[model samples]
Structures are given as structure tokens and as C-alpha cells.
Target: MNVFLGFLYVLKIILSSVASIFLMIAIYLLKKLDVFHINLRMLIMHALLCIFVNNIIQMLRFAISLSQNIKCSSHNQFPAPFCAFLCINGVFICMERLYATFNFSKYENENFSYFLAKIYAVLWMILTLCSLLKFWEGILPGRYNNSLNCELQMIRENPLKTQWHLILTLLFFW
Candidate 1:
């Protein structure tokens, strides 16, 4: 089990790093070429960059923890909040895309630029709020187990909330 977990961790780190790199390159090209004329596209790219940063931070914190093994710090202090941001951002994007699909004609009729801008703003505010949830009450530093692994905790700390969020995320994808 330990070996499997270790392998998973290594894979997670590698994949995250590679994703971050590709995302960064894409963002760079977008900015350099001025390809994205739409406000929504720019915001989506910005959110992608945010996730990229989140993944890099997670990888760094995990590496730091593995190397330092500092006894002073608790577990959740490492990468919990950013991890939560990643999950929330993902769900928010998925939900937004769903909404966009359903509201296609409405989006086309109205000035979609401002509409997208509003969604982008609201989604980012929600992401900020979700990330702060950890600082407020969601974080449980001492509890390190399968019930609260790094990925699961990204959704939320409350088991019921986590379960609901997971279901909702899956439904949104569907």
C-alpha cells in the first residue's frame, strides 16, 4: 500500500508539473500572439494559469514536506487550500460550460462579452471563498488518513459536503 501510494504521489507530481508547463506555454503563446479576443477566453486562460500555479504550489509543498519532514507544521498546512481551489475551479468551469451550452442562443443574442466577464468574476470570487474555507473551519490538521487524502480534501473537509460536491461534479460532467 505504501509503495502504491508513493507511486501515486510520484505520478501526481510528474503529471502536475507537466500540465503546469504546458499551461504556462499556452498562456504565453496566447498573450504573445494576442489570439484570444474574447474576454471570456482571456478569463478562462487566467483561470487555467491559476490552476497551474496551484499545481506547482502543491508539488513544491509536497516536495518540501517529503524532504524536510518538519515536525512543527501540521499536515493541512502544506497544500490544502490551493488544492481546494483547484477542485472548486474545476467544478466551476464545468458548470459554466454546461450553462453556456444550454444558454447558447441567449448568449449569442445578448452581449456575451459582459456576461462572460460577470461569470468569470463570480467564479473567481467563489474560488477565493472556497479556498478560505480551509482557514476558517474546514482544515483538520491532525487527521491524516484515507478518509482525508490530498485529493478528497480538495473538495471539502465535511464528509457529507465532500460527497455532495463529488456527486454534483460528476453530474455536471455528465
Candidate 2:
């Protein structure tokens, strides 16, 4: 089981890194060529940013799980970093989808240049702030597994907080 988990962790890291690199390259190439008109470029840029954020979240989650299992420094690293990533990505996902649904007619009526750019910038800033604040609460030191591991307490011990998160995420996604 340990070996399997280790393999999965490695694979997850590699895949996330590769995807990030690919997305970066795609964005660079698109910008360099200047081939696409304004509307298409805006859409492509939005997609690229979304993909980058999602893969970063996946990488952070994998790191947290592995660090916990190996009894590393989960307090200073795991909960905060992982939670920050989750919060940021979650907000982005929600905002992007919301914009598409709420402002679909705007895009259809006119070019997406102004609207897309503004929404993307606003979403990124909001996500950054939300993630930093939410995860910062778990920055204090704590012990786990009979002091063998010092980390933020598990979600199981704080079901109320976890349940709220689950519900909020569900609502955002749904």
C-alpha cells in the first residue's frame, strides 16, 4: 500500500507539472503569433489560466497527503498551502462559471475583449485573497499521531468546519 501510494503521488506531481508547462507554452505561443482575433484570444487566455490554477491545486493536494503520511511538517506547510490552493481554485472555478452563465448574452451581443479581461482580473484577485485568508487560520503549530507529527488537526476532528466547506463547494460547483 505504501509503495502504491508513493507511486501515485509521484505520478500526480509529474502530470501536474507537465500540464502546467504545456499550458504556459500554449499561452506564450498564442500571444507570440497574434493570430487569433480579440474574442478568441480572450477565451483561450481564460481557459489557460483556469487550467493552470486547477493543476496547481491538484499538485498541492497531493503534496499535503504525502507529507501527512510521511510525518513531515504539515502544520507550516500542509494545511495552509493546501487550503490556500483549494480556496483560490474554488473561487476561480465559481467565478468563471458564474460569469459565463450570467453574462452569456453580453458576449453574444458584443466582442468579449473588455468583459472577459475585466472578469478574469477580478476573479484572480478575489481568489488570491480568499485562499490566503482561509488558509492562514491554520498556520499555528499543533501535534498529531501522538506527537510523532506536528500539523494542523485533521478535518475529522472538526466536522463542522469541514461540513461547511463541503456544502459551500457543492453549492459553488452545482
Candidate 3:
């Protein structure tokens, strides 16, 4: 019974991952064209790209980890560095846009100064480097419960830190 259920669980993960990948690709395709040649919020675009790629990687890691022939629960630890960075990057993008929108004088110079745009690009590049530091500090999914249809529980060393980090970054968007 457990084996049958485990098979079903793996199937679900595969299906969901595929669906997510498709959705991400579709979104990318839809945005292939732009109204403006120069975009000020390029950081948001880079962040979104990171997120889409990271999600696919994370999903693949999860499915592979779960499908490993072992019946025991808790097999994977995808650090998902890019995924973690997405939260903070989201806030940064919001803040950058807000600042640019509010202080248009600096960015709207007739000389093609584009100070804000330059800052946005440089900031994302730096943040991308910084995000690499925690590429291996992602979620730890523990034991799959049969009753929960193979749902795994989170087993974290610092749940508070994770929770607070998410909450704090989210606050910036609001």
C-alpha cells in the first residue's frame, strides 16, 4: 500500500513540476516584446528570470529527491539560493521603482543620464552575487506523510529567521 502511494506521490510531483515549468515558459514568451526600448526597472526582469529558473531547478530537485527508491521520508535539501533571493529582490525592485518614480528629476535628465536605470542594473548584478552566498541554504523537507498524499513537513534549523525574513521583505512591497 505504501509503495503504491509513494508512486502516486512521485507522479504528482512530476505533474506539478511540469505544469509550473510550462507556466513559467508561457510567461516568458508573453513578455518577449516590450513597449519601450529602455526599461528602468530591469532589476525586476532579471529577478523574475532568476525566479523562473530557480523554481524549475527546485522542482526538479524535489522530484528527484523524492523518487530515490528509499521509503524513508526527508530525502532532499534544495538550498534554492535563487529562490531565497527572489523575496529580497522583489522588495528591492519595489523600492527601486518607487524611488525612481518619486524622484524623476535624477533619472529623467535630458542628457540620457539614466542614473536610476544604471543603479537598477548595477544593484541587481551585485545582489545576484550576494545571493550566491546562500545558494545551498534552502528548505529542508521532512518525512512524507501518507495521509497527506505525500506532503512533506518543513524541518528547519531556524524557522523564526526564515519566517521573519519573509515577513520583513514582504513589508517593503506593501
Candidate 4:
């Protein structure tokens, strides 16, 4: 079991590194591509950035654990928030698409200002942080064994908090 787990960790590290690189390249290309509207492109780039950062953090965590032979829980909180943001970003993208669909005639000529895109990104960041703050509070101190693995299960100790996280995720995803 230990060997298998080690193998999985190595696999995760490699895959995450590759994913982060690809996402970086994709974000660069998106910046150069003129096909997408500015607002939509910004949203897509934000999503990609979130994923890229999350992957890089995960890769680093796994690499540190393997190299130091210690399971560090300190960095565990880093990825969950980004994951939440990605979910929220997905909802924003969907909403933008729906708006365009409903107002197709006006959408073609509509110029969504870059400021609006920045606002949307900031709003999503704030929302994700607020929601995650409560969730993290439930698990951060005195909640579970500090050395135990699988931080996801540790966060589940408080069912109410877990439900809140799930509700938000499902709400955005739905």
C-alpha cells in the first residue's frame, strides 16, 4: 500500500506539472487569439489561471512530501479555494453565454468593457474566499489528526460546513 501510494504521488506530481505548463501555453494563446470577445476571453483566462495555479501548488506539495518524507498539511488549503473559484468561473462563463444567447442581436455589437471583466473576476474571488473561510475554519485547528492524510475527509468532520461547501459547488455547477 505504501509503495502504491508513493507511485500515485509521483504520478500526481508529473501530471500536475504537465497540466500547469499546458494551461500556461493555452492562456498565452488565448491572449493572442482575437476570435473571443474580451469579456469571455477574460473569464476563460481567469479559469485557466486558477487551474494552473492549483496544479502548480499541488505539484509542489506532492514533491515536497516525497522529497522530505513528510506529509505536510500546511499547504493543503491552497488548492481548495482555487478549485472553488474555477467552479464559480464556470458558472460565470455559462451565465455570459446565456446572456449572449438571449440577446443575440444586441450581443454582436455589444462591447463589454475590460473593467467589467475585472469586476467579475474580483467578485468571484471575494465570494470564493468568503465561502472557503468558513469551511477552512471548521478544519484548521483541533479538528482532526494533523498528521493524517486525505485533507478532504478531514474537512468533512463538520457536516454542516461540508454541506455548505457542497451546496455552493452544486449551486454554481447547476
| TM-score of each candidate structure, all chains considered together | 0.51, 0.51, 0.52, 0.67
> Per-residue CA lDDT of candidate 4, range 1-174, in tens?
257667877888888888888999999999998879877888888877766766775676566567756544443444456557767777878988999899988897777766666776686667567646744664455542322355556566764554455456556654
Q: Which RMSD does model 4 reach against the true structure?
A: 5.0
Model 1: lDDT of residue 30: 74
Model 1 TM-score is: 0.51
In candidate 3, which residue ranges exceed 4 Å CA deviation? 1-8, 15-19, 35-41, 71-80, 105-169, 172-174
Among all windows of 10 consecutive residues in model 4, the one with the lowest summed lDDT is 139-148
What shift in Å separates residue 9 of candidate 4 from its native position after superposition? 1.7
Model 4 TM-score, all chains together: 0.67
Question: Superposing all C-alpha atoms, what RMSD in Å does each candidate have to the true structure?
Answer: 6.5, 7.0, 6.2, 5.0
Clashes per candidate, residues 3 or more apart or on different chains:
0, 0, 1, 0
Better of 1 and 3 by lDDT: 1
Q: Worst 10-residue stretch by lDDT in candidate 1?
A: 69-78
TM-score pick, better of 2 and 4: 4
Tens digits of per-residue lDDT for model 2, 4-70: 6567667878989998899988988877786865566665665566557667765775676577664
lDDT by residue for model 1 over 1-174, one digit each (tens)? Answer: 255555655676798789889999888787677564444455557566666766775576445434543222223433334444445656656655676789877754443566666765776676667656643442345533432255365455675543554455335322
lDDT of all predictions:
0.55, 0.57, 0.50, 0.67
